[model samples]
Target chain A: MMTTVKQAEKFAAKTLTEDGLIDFFSGIGLIAIGYFWLIDNSALSAIMPLAIVNFWKISRKRISEPRIGKVTLARGKKGNVRAGRTILIIVSLTLAVGVILWLKGGAGDVQGTWYYPLFAAGPSLFIATITFFSAIYLKCPRFFGYAGWIIAAAGITIWLGEGPARALMISGVPFLVVGLWTFAKFLSAHPKADQ
Target chain B: MALKPEALDKVIHEPARLLIMTHLYVVTDADFVYLKRATGMTAGNLSTHLTKLEGAGFVKITKSFQGKKPKTTCKLTAKGRKAFEEYRKNILEVLKT
Candidate 1:
């Protein structure tokens, strides 16, 4: 047997926990968005379903049906907070900052210099937090962690700096691409256990 | 005892796989990607070990499409469950000597 195979199997075995499932589902959401753009043609529309997928994936995995049913990731003592907390935190901060910026600037136009940057902050912080948490959750850094950090950086850049929409578009594309690629790789490598 | 036994033993004896099986033995399904990351293995590596386990009839590998991508799940089989239990006892019995 290939030693790498043994290593991969060992890794898979450890990830068989509830927190692991959530991470995997978050990955699913990221990958689904890639395809969603193809089907819906609107990245905005894709976000909703992507959110929905995150919700659905967790719920689906959490409800365990006995015998040929879904299994739960192990939870001992306090369970690791999945992306849910991270998502909530990012959304909250984005809104808080958006509100603060809006109040400071006074709303002449909602989409002006203020809100676009605010919007960028949400995803930027989200990707960053996820990158941090999941990397920590895995007990080390992964290639995905690096990619996610880059996405987070682009998002932060879009938030802090003033630029043409084209700049946002340019940076956003690579961030999204790298995020999707990591998710796709994760999905392709997932093992199927025949019951 | 069996050619596959050594492979199964490798999985079973490993602290991580044993821990994984301890969880999976109760659950019906688990995502392989999650498993691999948790176990700290590479993509090609995990698949190979899975193939070995599946070949031994110690575990079941089910491949399905979750949207366009393949979602591979793993579950312990009746045979696998039985074999591991026996294997565990055998190990314990030997240790007692």
Candidate 2:
């Protein structure tokens, strides 16, 4: 009985990814970043992740929930999520402070130049970290696969001296392909439920 | 000790309703579509079980509109939660005996 209950809860949690919208949006975000980077638009690339977060939320309400329904898991299950968010906040603030200090320490106006190495390897590593915790928090192992692919892409790009754009585009392809296929399959399997 | 067969809450003893309560027990709330899928009940079957649970005051069902479409959400009421806990304890004791 206990095991069955746990299984039911797990099934509910699994709904987060079953529709494949997150992967789909994540792919679009990364590809957008790649395109934005290629065109020398750092600001737009930077905002892609945030934009995709909103898109994912909206898409879930519009697309996924209508089909599979909405199940908001218990708050007690979000301990890991709280920890993840705390760590993210700390890391982001630390990086912000470090950048400020770097500028103050006579590294003036080095937005794109002094940070070249960071740029080349940072997005992949950062996203890898985020997706890693996201996997744990969301109870979705596929995110671990995403994290691994991102890190591998980062390593390859850094070793080959390839730009971030190419690595991002490469990393985004699998998610896009998988997400599209999964979403299509999900739609077919779970049509809009009767109200 | 004699087994207290009467200790089990009859309202939740039904397998389908048991599954529904367990699912709602773990979550704050869930929609009709979600519950239907989680319980693998046919639309009419799930609706029947949910109505029974709702009538027993063990579950609260709210019908509202999400846009033009109808949406039904269910949550375990306080009475429902306590009854579920009580039911679990009784079942555990029975198993122990």
Candidate 3:
């Protein structure tokens, strides 16, 4: 029936809806950025995976999987190709820029002048790009909003010297709040599987 | 474009099964619960349709246990995908004629 297409589209949209996982991960990452200001930057990197794994375990056990059941979408070939292209572009650009800077002997000066801002912007840009691509690939428009938030946060950090901590929190808090809210709604929307 | 009644797939022509197939077409695999929620179909109704689809080789049903809970996941077979495409073409041809 013609209605089948509508129903299928609705199902696709539901699958893409935010359930708070993004918020949880990005929230912890932001909090880690705050810690980065006080401790070694490497510490934050180490904490990220552990934090994410723990959050995933908790969410699966307590929230999402128990309610809606675990749905693992197959990453189609197109998705893989897009991801591969994005990675290749980023790696190529980084290498080309590094080589140019090295040849010009401008690397040291640029790092000295713009280290903090560049450092902050790098991750922010990476997150924004991923979010943008995900929005397009998943047909989830909300990710575009998150991408905007990351860009804005990065812009603010660049404007304010010694603003990495604040920038991280600025971008991170919204994701955390939205994620938690979405999780709560998800819980209410889907009753316990046993029920 | 002349309409050919035989070109239509009777297996997929049924409404409930059509819905099930459409949902399966988008994702790689989905559990019974997820399909039930998406289709707004009763468990008995969905199970019956799934059995039919499975019998026709249009769907592959996998049964496994997660922490003692039985998990039933359904996937559209390559045959099913090709059949659905053909069905769509047949329907469009009918409409155009």
Candidate 4:
């Protein structure tokens, strides 16, 4: 934690409006897909936006910085944990497409089987979990911070059938709100540290 | 290509401005107080650099009230972002030399 102060001070923090919104859009994009996953897969609503937001944020960082700091540049890579992420996305999309095909293929009920959701939900949820844990360790109010974890946990609960799907949706509302506040706090607390 | 040659060099030349641009580039935008803190400069000193930037039209400043408190926001102009990119390039080039 003491070392985190130097770490924190070494970098500049973005304002609630700027830094926060980037994460907010990203958070919303992920949640939107997760919600679509819960409701109907045909919506095709979440994937494009998620892809767009993620790519945009990535390009913004890489393009905006000319000779990026070694620290920040490295962190932006989102892990060359490339295989795990690619597999997660590909499998999740495949499940989504399969489920939609099933529903439209004359199976009216979209109720998912336990085994199937493990394939669809598990990987996505796991990624969120990684994000959640990292945010906690970083001592920042990143979108994947506690609020994200709480919503994500609820989503996991829903996937496991321990909680209602609505619980996941309801859990997310607070993340949308308080995540902004926490981001502001992060910025305010470190106002002079960048200098 | 993302940065104009002139703007990039301008921001690159000064160590403080280089620091300032790097900080701003990271967070997207910053305020006077945050800049002061990050740069370790006094308010007046921060203000002077800010004024120079504001005059050059690299950064845009907005003054408003956040309830009873006055809030000032400083955002990089497209011009300013170009300058930051330029600054980065110049530094890299210099280091290479």
Please, what are the lDDT tens digits per residue for candidate 3 over residues A26-144? 67776676567536576776677577768776766556655665555656458666785777579457545554654566534343453445554665666667667766656677778
How does model 4 score by TM-score? 0.46
lDDT of 1 by residue, B1-97 (tens): 4234453366567664565555456444576755554455666767776777778777788898755656678888898787677766766666574
Encode model 4's per-residue lDDT on A33-86: one tens digit a residue: 557656767366446475756765664333322112112211333554565467
Highest lDDT model number:
2
Question: Following a full C-alpha superposition, what root-mean-square deviation does model 4 have from the true structure?
Answer: 10.5
Docking class of 1: incorrect
Fnat measured on candidate 4: 0.05
- Please write out the lDDT profile of model 4 over residues B46-76, one tens digit for every residue: 7787777778777887787645645567777
Candidate number that wins on DockQ, 1 or 2:
2
lDDT of each: 0.52, 0.84, 0.72, 0.52
State residue A90's C-alpha deviation in candidate 3, in Å: 2.9
Tell me the interface RMSD of every candidate, in Å: 10.0, 2.1, 2.7, 11.5
lDDT against true structure, model 1:
0.52
lDDT for A189 (candidate 4): 48
Clashing pairs in 4: A192-B37, A192-B38, A193-B37, A193-B38, A194-B38, A195-B38, A195-B39, A195-B40, B8-B86
**In candidate 1, which residue ranges exceed 4 Å CA deviation?**
A1-10, A13-72, A75-91, A109-122, A138-140, A143-152, A155-160, A163-195, B1-20, B23-97
Q: Quote the RMSD, in angstroms, for model 3.
A: 3.6
